[model samples]
Structures are given as C-alpha cells and as structure tokens.
Target chain A: MSFLPQLAFVLILGVAGYILSKRIKFLRRNIFLGKAETRNDHTDDRWKTMALVAFGQQKMFKRIIPALLHLLIYVGFVVINLEVLEFILDGILGTHRLFAPFLGGVYTAAMNMFEFLAVAVLFSCVVFLTRRYVTKVERFQKPEMKGWPALDATLILVIEIILMIAVLTMNATDQILAERGADHYLALGPLFFSGLIRPLFEGMSLEALHFIERFAWWFHIVGILAFAVYVTYSKHLHIFLAFPNTWYSNLKPKGEMVNMPEVTNEVNMMLGIPTEAASNPSAEIGRFGAKDINDLSWINVMNAYSCTECGRCTSECPANLTGKKLSPRKIMMDVRDRAEEVGKSIDAGGPGLEDGKSLLGDYITKEELNACTSCNACVEACPVNIDPLSIILQMRRYVAMEESGTPAQWNAMFQNMETSFSPWKFSPSDRFNWAEKVKEEEM
Target chain B: MSENYKVPTMAEMAGKGETPEVLFWVGCAGSFDERYKAVTQAFVKILNKVGVSFAVLGPEEACTGDPARRAGNEFLFQMQAVANIQVMNGYEVKKVVTACPHCFNTIKNEYPALGGNYEVIHHSQFLQQLINEGKVTLKGGGEFKGKKITFHDSCYLGRANNVYEAPREVIKALDVELVEMKRCKTKGLCCGAGGAQMFKEPEPGKKDINVERTEEALATGATTIAVGCPFCLTMMTDGVKNKEREADVKVYDLAEMIAKDMGI
Candidate 1:
C-alpha cells in the first residue's frame, strides 16, 4: 500500500484537502465570532433529526421534485463512497474487490449497489441541474448567483459526471479481469461489459488484460482523489457542512425573539423589539445593534456558512415568492460577503471590520425587514433550520430601539403602545365597555 | 349582564401578596373592542354554567401589557404589570383567565419577572373544558349543515402556549364540514396583527397577508373562517371584505359560534 506512486497521490490530496478545509473553517468561524444562541441537548433529538432531516428530508419535500432529486443524490453520494474505495483497493491492494474477507464475498452485491447508486445519482444530478439552470429557482436568482459559485457548480457537475462514467468503465474492466480469474470478486452490471471483453480474452487472455486494467485502475484512483480534494474548496463544501449544521440549528419558536440586554430599565423588559438600546453603531460611543457580520453571534455566522444553498428557505419565503425585496438566501449571503470582506481586512489590517453602518443599512434594506410577516414558513421548510425570522426581528429591534426610525404609521403605533397598552390607543377605561353590549345569547 | 373588570395597579395594593380563587384579567381586546363582546359573554356564560365563581374587577384589571412591551414601550408595559400584580394582591385573585390570546401570553409568560405571577388560562381553554364536561349544551338547535370552514390558529394560542387542540375541538364539535388551509397548526400564518402591528398599518407587503390568508381559506371554499383570537377575527373579516367576497365569507370568533349553537 505504500507504493511510491500511490503514496504521492494520497499525499497530494491530503495536503490540498487539509488546506481548503482549514480555510473554509477559518472563514466560517470568524464571520460572526460571538456567542451561540443557547446550546441544546443534541442527544435528545439526534435520531429524530436524522430521521427527519437525513432520511425523511421532511423539510425538503415542501417542493416535491427537487426534494426527490436531493434525496437520491444524498443517498447516492453516501453509497458511492464504496466505489471510490474499491478503485483505490483494486489499484493499490492489487485486487478488483475489497479484501475484508467476510465482506469480500459480498462484493457482487455491494458493487452492484454502488453501480446502481452511481446511475441514480447521475440522473439526480441531471434533474438538479435542470432545476437550478433550466427552471432557475428564485432562491438562486440573486444578483450574486451570476458570479463564482454558480460557475463553480457547473464545472463541478461536469467533472462529477465524467469521473463517474470513467469509473464505471473501469468497474466493467474489473469484472472482466475477475471473471477470468484475475481476482475481482464483483459481477453485476460489470458482467455485461466484462462479457464483451471475453472475446478478447478468448484467445490471448489474462496477462494482457491485467496490464490494461492496471493502467485504467491507476487513472480511476487518482481521478477520484482529485475530485475529493476539489470538493473541499468548491461550492460543494456544504456537502460536508450540512450535517453539523442540522445538528445545531436554533431550537426555539420562530416568533419568539432572543432575550437581549435591557439597555433602559423601568420600561419593564423589552419583549419583542427594542425601541432604545444602541443608536449609531458607527459612533465611537456606540452600543448599537449589528450593522454588519461582526456583531452577529457565532451561530448566526454558522447559519450563513451552514447554508446548503439548496434554496428551500427562499422558496418557501412568502416575501420572495410575492416579489418583495427579501430573498432570505440573499440576505444571508450578503451578510456572509461582508464578513468575508472583514476577514480579508483582518488579514491585511484594514478599516474593514464592521465599521459604522448598521445591519439595517443597505445590506438588509428596511423594505426587506418590514416585508416579513414573522410567519416562519421559511423556518419550517429549511432543511437546516435557519430561522430567518430571528435575523429579521433583530434588524427590527435595532431600528425600533436605538434609531426610533420607521414609517409614520409604525411611529403612531409605537405612541399608541405607550398610551393605549394596546396598539390602537383604546382608552383603558372603556376596556369592559364591550361586555355591556353583548346580549348574553348573541351567538 | 354587566360587571366591572379592573387590572390591579401596584399603587393600589402598596404591599403584600394576596391570592384569590381566580384572577379575572380582562384583556384589552376583550375590554375595549365591542366587536369581541360575544366572546366575553359566551366565556362568562360558560364559566357560570361550569360553577366556576369568577369575579370581574372592572377598573382594577390593567392591560396585560403585551402590546406596550412589544412596541418598545417596555416602561409602560412594566408599570402595567406592577399595577396588575398590586391589584391581584388586593383582590386575593390567585388564578387568572382571559379570552384574549395576547393577555394569556403576557400574564403567563411575561408577568413572573415583574412579580405578577398567577395560574393563567385562556377562555378558549376554559370553555373547551366546560363543553367537554357537558356543562355547556347546545339546545333547541340541531346540527346545522354549512359550507366547509377552516380555523385560523392564533400565534399565541397555538405555538406560544401549545394550546392547538381546544379551538379546533370547538370547531369539530359543530356539525359543519371542515377543510384545512395549506398552512395550519405549527405552520399557521400570522394575520399581520401580532407584535403590536394591530395598531400600526402593515409593513406594505405586495399581497396583504390577511388577504393572502383569507384567499387561502377561500381557496378551501370554506363558507366561514373560524378563529379564536379577537385580532384574527377582526383582521380576517376585513381581509375577506377587501377581497370583495365579504358576503361570501364571514369570520366568526369561537365563542360567538359556540354561543350561537347553544340557546343560552
């Protein structure tokens, strides 16, 4: 297994994989380097989350076809890991099948399973591409989607399809060699192609085929490793990130806002939105709300990176669906882009680490925040449980509390909330007046 | 037919804690909005029928302070909370109940921090129990068949307080056919009325959310939109009316529907 060529290949992949993984982790960690939104007991719902999120994909099914495609790809992605291993083992271990002994005899079953999955996933990826490029889901139509990530995804898809087909060919060759007593224990779809190779084997047989198989074996092994390394850096990072994210999602009610600091006392505790906490975050003495990514909690940052970009949240968002200024996906992405800017600044020691402008500035326009009805449909439909409502409410609180800035009607409502104890400014004395009019049997 | 319901102000009691058989906090919507009168009357009627001797402190009950607090007027919300606690101490009211979901949330979830703690129950919950216990009966009325209807689950009563079944139970008890909206129960849509938005103009959505909701109900072809909260009833009624389907659809509070079925 320590052959010079194989070692060199693995070493290349290992280092490249390590670098990209660390860089993304670094970017994700620093985006919002504050506290988490209350840790939860994962052990309690781990199985439930797995059942619902991993297998059931209950959230994804909100949109039928895409959900089905995603499920197939997810399962295929998991099952195909075996093929990659089979390639490596056949190339380096000098065998066409896994040699775990007891596990070896089942290679026919196992290889067929992997091959079947590869076909399914390939088809799934096709449907996914159509959904993304042809159908062009609204979640992916953000102004930014025309940029790098979309291009990267298209390139990756091409590579995956080509790589999988090549490996499938190599699998066919393995079947031919194995049937001729060349030692591969697999024979399923591999058998059909292997049967074709039988004619060549009929006259001058195993030795020539072994040499051909050896070279094909090396190409398949290296190709897989290269793709594996590329995924760590590409848009495919969510492939690794989604599981951990699903585990740590905010576990509270969608309408229930987080408990914030009591900037002013005696006004009782501010329940829903803050009306007067911090004003100008750009100010030197400012204790203002989040103007950018820096002020958000670590979990909020995670929510951004944790985004699978599957677009489920944006698809379910009533605002986005109705032509509003809010695409929950875009809002999170903008926050993330700003954080990446800050990360670059930190690396260069510049004036970029969340300066004066608040989160209410252009990034999350007031129109977008106001557009939400706090209905939480997006939250319910999110595969990773990102609560877009919480972010919207925070912006609402910052605007309401510190700035006291909003439309005239909202201002009036605030005034009424102070006087009427209800937003309508109804006189408290007439509170029971409604009861006087009810004829006891009006129903 | 008429009684006083006052929310206790802290100054009235000055000091000392008192607990009564039950605290009658008349929620602002129940108190000031005459449109919600049937809900209040039905609740009172049901309470009496169940032999739960409840008293109304007409002026003693203050606002539960949910709106004020949610609207960035926390100071006012606090003052109201303190005053209610003081009044409750004076009346010796230990248990609290109200027809309004807003009042239920403020009293049960928000009051403990300000020393205004008591066992609180929404009237929908209480009345549902009464109906279940056979204390409240429908008389001189048979099962009147109507078009299918959907129930609008209020945020507070449904998700916040986990009181999803009671209102639906009341609706099911009626012989009218029922259909469900795409979003119901935990995933129910808000009427653009919670979080003090009731007093303010909505945030200018492309589609008026209530209308969107009413249309969703209309899509189900339900003749009536049954609701438990006064705000939901008011907003949805206005929403249905604005869609020019006012005659086609009517929003009825759970109490009004229940009281109608029973010849009280």
Candidate 2:
C-alpha cells in the first residue's frame, strides 16, 4: 500500500514531464518557423547581456518601486525552488522531510530560509495583485490587456499565492506531527513563519495531522508541476525565454536598422556594379518583408514569445501617447497570437500558413504599422530588449515593397526622392544655395 | 561674415588634386530648408573659426537615402547609397561630418554593407570635440548667459547613437543655466520627425507628437529650446509657433547657440 503512493507520485510526475516536454517541443517548432538569421557573433558580449539583463534584472530598476517588489518575487521564485528537489526525493521515496536526518542543523536553516522567501513571495504577489486590480496601473490596463492577458496575469499571481500557502501549511502540520512523535516526521527545528501557524494543527489527531501534511505536500508539488506546464502557454514564458532572448539581443547602435543584402544585390545589378564572383544567377528570391509569422527572423518570433505584456513599450511609445493606433505591446501580442494559431493548426494537421490569414492584415492593421515613427522608444523601453520597431519596419516593408501600398504622402515623397534626389522637388544644382546667403553676409 | 568663411566644394578641391580633412555632408534639410540654412552657416562659421579644413559635396552630393530606407523603399535607398558611395570612393573621401542625425546614423552605420565606409561624426559630437580641443573659444556669460536653455535630444543622436552628453556639454560651455526636460537623455521624448515622419502628415491622433514634446520642453521653463538635428529644428520651431510662444521661447540648434556665444 505504501508502494502504491510512490507509484502514484511517479505516475503524476511522469505525466507532467511528458506534457511539459511536448509543449517545449511545440514552442521550439513554432519559433523555428521564422527565417534563420545569425545572432551568434560576439559570444562574450552576448553572455554579458544575458547575465546583466536577464539574470541580474538590471533594466527593471528603471521603475524603482516595481523593481524592488519584482526583485523580491524573482529572488524568492529562484530560492524557493531549491526546496523542490527535497520534495521530489521525499515523494519518490515515500519519506517525509528526507533531508532532515541527513543534514541535521543545515536542513533546519534551509527550511527557515525557504519559509522566509515563501512569505516574501506571498507578500509581493498580494501587492502586485492590488496594483493590477485596485490601483489599475496604467501599463497593465491597456486595451491589449483586457481579455485573456489580464486573466492570465491574475491566475499566475493567485496560483503562486495558493502554492505559498500550501508550503506553509505543509510545514506547520509536519512540525506538529514531529512534536507528537509521528512516524516518518523528523523533529527539525522550528521554521519561524510556519511555526506561527502551527496552532491551527496543534489540536488535530495524529492520524489527521499526518494526512493533512501529506495532502499539502502533494498539493504543493503538483501545483508546481502544473504551473511549469502552464508557463509555456502564458506570458509567464518570460521566466524561461528572457535568458535566450537577451542573449541574442541586437548589439549594434540602435539607429542602425538591419540592411537587406538581397536588396543590395538587386541594386548592384541595376546600377551595373560588378557582382561578387560567388553570386548565383539562379538564386531564389524571398518575399521583401514580413507578411506572416514565417516571414520574420527567428529572433523576432522569439521576441514575440518572450513578451511579458508589461506594456512598457506601449506606455513609452510616442504614437501611443498621442492617441495613435500604434501600440507596440499590441504588435508583439498579435505576433505571438498568430504564431500560436499557426502552431496549433499545423499540429492538428490543418493548413498552416495557407490559412489565407496573416499577421499583417488579419491580426495587425496597416494603420498600426503606419503610425510608428520608428523612433526606437519601444525598443529602448523593453526590459528584455524586445524590438517591436523591427517588426513594424518589416511589415511596413511588406506594405511598401510587396503591395506598393504606402500612404499617398509617402508615395509622393518617394517619387520626389527618385526624380530629384530629395524628398522635395529642389534641384541638385541648387544644393549649395544656402551658401550664397553666407557669402551675402560676407559682402 | 568674414570673407574667409567660404564653403569649398569637394569637386572644387578634387579638381586641384586636394582633399579636405573632413567632408561636410550638408544634408538635404541643411542645404534647402530656409530655417535650417542658418544652422548650416553657423556650423560652417564655427568650423572656419576652428581652422578645420572641410569641403562640401555641392552639386555632386545626393541624398543619403535615409528617408526612403526608413519609409521602406529599400530599392531607392540603395540606389542613392550606391551612387553616393561611387562618388565619395572616387574622391577617396575618408572622414565625414554632418549636422543631421538621420544622415549621420545612416551613413555611419548603414553604408558599410553597400561598400561605403567613412569616419562619420554628428556636428554635436564634433562641436564638443572642438570645445575639448580648446579650438572653439566661448566668451564668459555670452548672449545665452543667465537665460535658461534646455537641450532637446534628437532620437537618432541620443538613443540611436548614444550621443547624449555632447550637445549638453556644448550648451554648458556658454556659461548658461541648462535645465533638462522631464524626459531627457535615454528617456527623452521624440520631436516626431524621425522615420520619414518629417515628410508626411502624422496619422490622425488626439494631438501632434511635436506639440506633446513641446509641452514638456515648455514645462521646463527654459527660454531657449536648443536642438541638435534640422528635423528637430523644424518640428520644435513649429511646436513653439503652435503654442504661440515663439516670441518668448526661441528654438535654436546647438550650432547656432555656439555661433551666437562666440559672436561668429
């Protein structure tokens, strides 16, 4: 009968692991759906970026209050998970507090530390919940955050609170069971926070106490497993993706937009410049710019998945502040949504990219793309270096190059640039007319 | 203006088998915009005062293709880029200085792939360098002294290229009180002229971006709104006009301020 519980624990873990791996594979496939672009140069610099931006959470300090609150949760999330290893071993072996007898005083100290972090996580989650629901922080209340995004954020916080409660409940009951000399419950020193809550379980029967301890332990571990699987589907994926995303961040000057080598080759041909000796005459030409998820670079798609919906990009956007239709946060969310849609359809053996819908027209509108000033404010504001402007520029390229659908004013400017080498119709011969004014001042 | 303040062309110098130390890339705005022409002249005046050998491209110069590239017309952008590269490479042009952030950014960062590479410096950074070298001397408490001035960060120069301190340093050299906008440096608001927005009307919005940015600048209570790019010069100038604060609040580029401070 004891073996039956171990078997059940093993089975549950196996199922959770299987589901988590499947979801990870799905994400990898979807991310690779984008065109390949090299981001591996400067390996040393990439590592430093990952360390400072992702691991160190350096950019979060831009807003001091939230940075402090978020640091508590981030540190607590990492530190508390160290206790999960013991939980896993205990469940597999059908032993309670597996490390208590082996490590002696160290086990008590570790539990105390974990308990401290659990309380901190709980406190931070409550403050965050209030900030989201009560105060309604402006960034969290944007239009893109109205539906499932809002619900997902609330669900993560609520789930975290319940998990923290489960940890404390289990600790308190186990402490009571140990004091009562129950089997398999080691008498570790008091966990300060959970000790305060031991009064609730003090009057229970030994058997009942044991059962409640077992129940809370199972709930805490199982909830963690479920949460791990759920993160892949939520904006909470930033918990995992932020590292890789920052590692591959664009390192060039923010003013430098990506150049099109294909366009360079075409222009070279047009200008009668000698092509590279290795240039192939029969090379296939790809679409000019991003029209769908597949058209963007893999890093761009990963950027979409890595978005935490903080709405920092949108809040900082000049266009968004001026009441324009361009919300950079919405652009990222749309790309992620379209990616999910395409990934699921392909998984179900349905038509994928041929679904006759695209990220450009169906998900994001031309008006949104047109409203971007390409100012890089959104890029600067992203904590994880998400480049919504790059996606905006790519879609603009599709509208201009593929559809030739730039606005009338832009078309006029383009014509002027072509005919007179200026956005206006001024003659090149008169380029130095301003100098005449300087000479007249001299006279 | 001194008779020595002559803007020599690259062709004029190249015809005599001579090359200036730096090629002054007079961007389309600097060459044509009536308001920005003064900026071009002021920078020229400072360069002359510093005794820097600089030459303009004159009739041979073409657009740096920044607007077309930002507007998503890559074909046109590259055509212009290739044409300009051919002309510059023919002259063995090695160093370039420009007053426009857009042109500076495009030529410095984007042109290398198209076989055009030159040491490019924005006029703000160049001005700061001149000040550092003790070449461009400033009078104590010159025209801008005791008057409050706020330097607006052009997007291309500030966030794009991370040239935040140069313009501010140049302004500080005039012995003026430099007040910063609430949003300055990395967090500075755009003047709404980047990405070819200067060439087209903005999409329908509750307010124009420049007016919104100008409100922040005005809130600083600075009498002079200093700028670094010609696009910023036009946008902020119009913004001051929109608020009808033109008489009380004047917008000048960094070069113009230096020129005034030096009595050039």
Candidate 3:
C-alpha cells in the first residue's frame, strides 16, 4: 500500500479526534493542580513514581495477585498496538504480505515476533475479563454503571476480544500457507483459521483464501484505529490521559491547612456555617468557597478528570463506607456527570462557575465534609495521589474562619487551647511540671 | 551539614545567664496532661547519668499550635506560633528536645514556614544516642521474658518523622518478647486522635479507635502494649479499659517502662 492514503486517514482522524475532544469539551484546564507542594513536584526523590504510578498502574489493583492479572492485560494492550500500522499498510496497498518479498527471512521473523505479542495480548484480555467477572477485584467491579457509560465499557471489552481473535485466526491461516512454500519457512500463517476457511476456499481454489486474507487485513487495521478514536472520548480515556495527569499532579503541601479568606465585616457576615455561597455577583460579594463545580479551582476539577475511577479513594473513605452521604466515587462521578450534562453551556465559554448549578448546593453537605477524619488514607490510597485531605481542609477553613460555625466540641477545644495553650483543658501554669521530674532525675 | 536540629524555643530561657547545649521542650501532654511527663524528665535523668547536662525549657514552652492548625483555624495557629517564636528567641537557646511526636514534627517541618527556625530532637532519638555513646546504663524493665508485648507506632513519630527504630530498640533492649501489630510502621492505623481530635470528642461510632487498636494488641495475645507517644498511651489505655480488655493488656510508655527497670 502506498503510504499516502493511510497517512491521510491518520492525519484526518487525528485532527477530528482533537477537534471533537474540544467540541465535546471533555478535557478542561491543564496544570490543574493547586499551588501547593505535592509529591509530583518533588520528583527528585521518586522518579519511579512517574513510571509506576503513571504507567505501571500501581493504583489499579489494590489487591496484589489480581492486580497483577490486570497489569498484564494493561501492558499487553499497549505493547501490541504498534502492529496496527503494518496491518493497515498491508491491507491497503497489498504490497506487504506476512513478510517482505525482498528480505523474506528478516521480514518474516519480525512478523513472527509481533504475531506472538498479539497472542499474548489476547490471552491477557481474556484473563482480565475473567477477573472482572469471576474473581472480581471489587475496585474494578463496578455494578452501578448506568446509561451509556455502562454500555461503553462493555463495548470496549467486546471490541478488544474481537480484534485479538481475528488477528489469531489470520495469523493461523498465514502459518499453514507458509508450510507449502520454501520461502514461507518464516511466516507461520495458514493457521487455525485456515482449516475452517480451507474447505470453502479449496472449493474455489487457493485464490479465494488469498481474497480472504485481504479482508482480514483491512478489518484489523481500520477497526483498531476507530477504536482508538472511540477511546479518546470514552471512560477508558484514562488509558492515555492518566499518565499526563499524574505527571503534572498538584504536589501540594502535606500539612498546610488551606486558609479561609478572613471576614472583616464580622457583624454583617452570617454567623454560623454559611452553608450557602451568598451570590451577589458584584466584585466584592462575599461568598463561601466552591459554590459550584466551576467555582472549584482548576486543580479540583482536574482531580475529577485525573481520577482513574479506581475507587481507592472512595473505598477507603470512612465516611462513605460507614453509610454516610459522601463517597469519593459519587463526588467524582457527580462532577463528571454534571460536566457532561452542561458541556455546551461551558463550551459557550462564558463565566465559569459563576452560573452553573452549584456543586455543594446540590450534592455535598456539612455533615459529609465534617465526617472526614483528615486521616489521608484516601489520599494515600489514590494511585494518582489526589488529596481529599486538602479539599476537606479547605471546606473546614471556610466553616471555622469565615463562618465560625463549629460544633460545641470544637468550641470547647478552642476555649481550652486559648487559655492553657493546649486543648486538654488542663492548668496552664503546669505546662512545665514535667521539668521537675527531669531535675529530680539529675539529682 | 544540614544543621537541621532544633534551636531552643524561647520559653526555655528566662533569666538564665547562658545558652545551654540542649533545651528540653516538654510538650503539654508530657508536662501536665499525662503521667508520661517522666518520658522527657526521666530521659534527662538518664542523660545526666551519662554526664550530659541539659537545660529545661518549662514555663516558656507553649503549645506548638498543632491543634489549631489542624482544626482549620489558621489565625489561632499563627497567633500561637508567633508567641512560641518570641519565647524561643528570648532564650538564645541552641538545641531543643521534646518527647511529644506532634511537637517534634511541627517544630521540625512546619514552624520554619512561619519563621520559627529551630533544631529539634525527640527525646527517644536523643536517649538512644546517649545509650550508644555509653552515657547511660540500660538497667531497666525487669526481664519481661514470658510476656509478649505489642508496640504501637505513634503516627507523628513513625510516619511523619520516620523515626521507627528508637522505641523498638528500647523495647528490644528490655529483653521482652516483642509482638508487632499487623500495621506497625508507616501503614499503622491512626489512633483516631490526630488532627486535634484528641481534645475534641470523636464522631460517634460503634467503637473508639483506641479500643479498636487495643483489641488488636489483645489479639496478638500480648500481655502489655507499649507506646512512644503519651497521647497513644493514654488513648490506648482508655481503649483497653473501655473494652474491659485491660486485664489482657497493660499499656505503658517506653519511658515509664525503662524507668521501672532502671530502678529510677
């Protein structure tokens, strides 16, 4: 096949994919992390985190052996993709068969290597499917998927299964045909598929099987590329987007609490947990932080995108598991669903967050935010390293600093800390009593 | 080369004429809040046994503002931080030691951001050094040979500052049979007492975090539970008592355990 036509198809599709991504408005905001110290920025210590977390997928399989199965499937898919080009070139121009005519042995050897890789990938996907269904790792086992998203995941699995099987069948046919010819010592086609098609082709002569080869070649090449485009817009976009997201992670401060904007007009500002972001939209209008999804800083929204939906954050969250209102899964899904629902409006590119339905107003609650232990287990579990602690801290700051709305326990703790310089409600002057013990020891 | 050790907090020096080589900054929990005050004082007692003289920074010492900062009140944290810095600068003290892991981590990692630069050491590390230097005798804890004991890694001490070995070394030196909780080091579960949750009541749950951990210790069939942080000891003891599992496990601070064996 001449390089011109396939190259043209690639460029056209690439542009369409790029433009459609924008039109669909799926990706929003780059460098979308907060201006804080995150581990990603401190790459000097952990260069491997980039590879392991970003590529090796340390986050996907929380469980060891099952995760390994998932890893094999993940790696297999990535490794075999390079072969699609050769299949395309062979199909369009009929210039290359299983091997190059000019350099028969070398070309045939390369095909043999790639053919084996394809087989491995096929086996991997089958095991991964089995793991997803049978001995399912709960994190990957999402039964709650509804509407198009649910269907999309299934379609993806089906496509991969079909591609792998077709490649195997085609390669089998090639191996059988190779046995007939001396130059065919290298190509292993005329494979398992050849026998099935053989009787039919034999009735029409080997010429018909040659015709069958042309169809298989075309089918594998075009089908994979279209699938690639489909993935760009699909939930599976993490296959590509996750790496870049992890690289540019927030790398925010480990313990620095988010500062709430202080209130100067103490009297006019609502006194207790200003649950709403009073919107007078004027330049100096006082509002609670994060009125809506768009109101969330670019990094927070990026967190929603950066999520692999691994469920690590949600699964470990004490609030969610204990049957509380919050689930990091629900939180992220809420953002994703809300974003897709309001895409065109956002694409209109008017004021962001100023207009959309408020995120906190609709989904989150004071109890849910307060229930967080700030334990950072969710942060630790996240493969991409998004920090739920930071978000909770921000909301906490809004409640304490701006609204001064805290439960009586917090009120009492503060009173104790203020008087005694400690929160234990103990005598302040006794702060140094331990020193007497140290002195007695010396004597 | 790093000169990363804590400088004496101002509260340590009052009318004291000269700078001291080490300023022991006993945290509130170590001083007035818990009986574990002996951890720092007895540690100094041991240091004196090794002929290492240290100054105590008592009255001038105040909260490290960890509670306020963690509870999301930045203004209160800054206020306490400013006051603590002033007390430290007044002393011209050089080195600081604190028994509390919370104070150690906040002083070592966070204080510099607000301009409180100090060289800080946890007494556990300092005491271990004293032992290594042959400054103090390890005459402590009558051989706890038959009793299996579990060690709880304090969050701030182990994960925050990466000081995993000192307390464990102390336990090993006692010749006690050591049993480790499933989650001992970095992966150790929080005692449900961090983020200033200690002073504040916990959200209602079926069981307290401390009791949950105490049950973990009892499951190991350990007769005693040892802890480095005073907060952990207090909470875990309460947890054991609450579960009525105190008969199975007695919680002790590494300091009290060592002092008993040292015959101090």
lDDT at position B164, candidate 1: 81
Q: Which whole-number lDDT from 0 to 100 does residue A242 have in model 3?
A: 67
**What lDDT tens digits, residue by residue, belong to model 1 across residues B1-264?**
534332233333333343335555667667767677667776665554455656676655667666555554444556676677766755656788887888787777766665667788877777687778887765524433555879988877876667888887777777677788998886677776776667666654467667777878888888889888888988898888888988767888877777667644
Name model 1 segments beyond 4 Å from true: A1-4, A36-38, A41-56, A61-64, A82-102, A135-160, A177-238, A261-289, A355-358, A438-443, B1-25, B55-57, B60-95, B110-120, B139-146, B159-163
- Kindly report which residue pairs in candidate 2 clash with one another: none
Better structure of 1 and 3 per TM-score? 1
Candidate 1 lDDT at A59 equals 72
Off by over 4 Å in 2: A277-279
Give the per-residue Cα lDDT of candidate 3 at A342.
Answer: 52
lDDT of 3 by residue, B49-103 (tens): 4555466666667788887777767666666666776667666656777778788
Best by DockQ: 2
Q: Rank the candidates by lDDT, best first.
A: 2, 1, 3
Best by TM-score: 2
Q: TM-score for all predictions?
A: 0.82, 0.98, 0.80
Q: How high is the lDDT of residue A151 in model 2?
A: 97
Model 2 TM-score on a 0 to 1 scale: 0.98
